[model samples]
Target: MRAKRTPVLDRACRACGFSDSRGLTHAKLQSGETVTLCGTHELMLRRAGGAVDAGELRGVLSDRRDTVRRSVGGGDELAESLQEAFAPNRRRTERRAS
Candidate 1:
């Protein structure tokens, strides 16, 4: 019996070493070897006559937006700030040693 084959893991972007594959570009060479590129390098490649995906560009943006949204919560900042502002303040008067 033949051993099962493992899935191919993605490599870092050849241009910038970015490992996430979400916004990278890819190409298959004339020799049938494939390479990946980061967003900036991918744009350069496209402007230089290489064909890349529009979906890829949008994918990167959407992924970044979702990450930011997750980091920023839906809680009311104004309410929190107001509560903090109205809380009691304690002032300590230190007695000087005579």
Candidate 2:
């Protein structure tokens, strides 16, 4: 008989309990335990070579939030640029520019 396994996205982070489909990922530890971790914990585990504790989870989560906030603080420049390039009136100009 086989044990039932939890679905990947349905599992909570082993370190912090953060559960979002996009932010979750799986990692296999040296002990052969497969754990689902949020992006922050996964990064911490990879860098420090150990499981992140609950106390450390808070700091890591905050740092990750800040880093993501800073990186995405830029306005939607890509969307705007893409829209401008693909706008119907700009079709001829885009061809000429290319």
lDDT agreement of model 1 with the native: 0.57
Which residue pairs clash within candidate 2?
Answer: none
> Residue 21, candidate 1: how far off, in angstroms?
2.3
Q: Which digits, one per residue and each the tens of the lDDT, describe model 1 over residues 59-96?
A: 43233333545546655998778766665551124435
Best by lDDT: 2
lDDT for 70 in candidate 2 is 50
Local distance difference test scores for all models? 0.57, 0.66
Clashes of each: 0, 0
Give the per-residue lDDT digits (tens) of candidate 2, residues 5-63: 86454377866677786889887665555667888778887787654454543454444
Model 1, position 79: C-alpha lDDT score: 75
Candidate 2's C-alpha lDDT?
A: 0.66
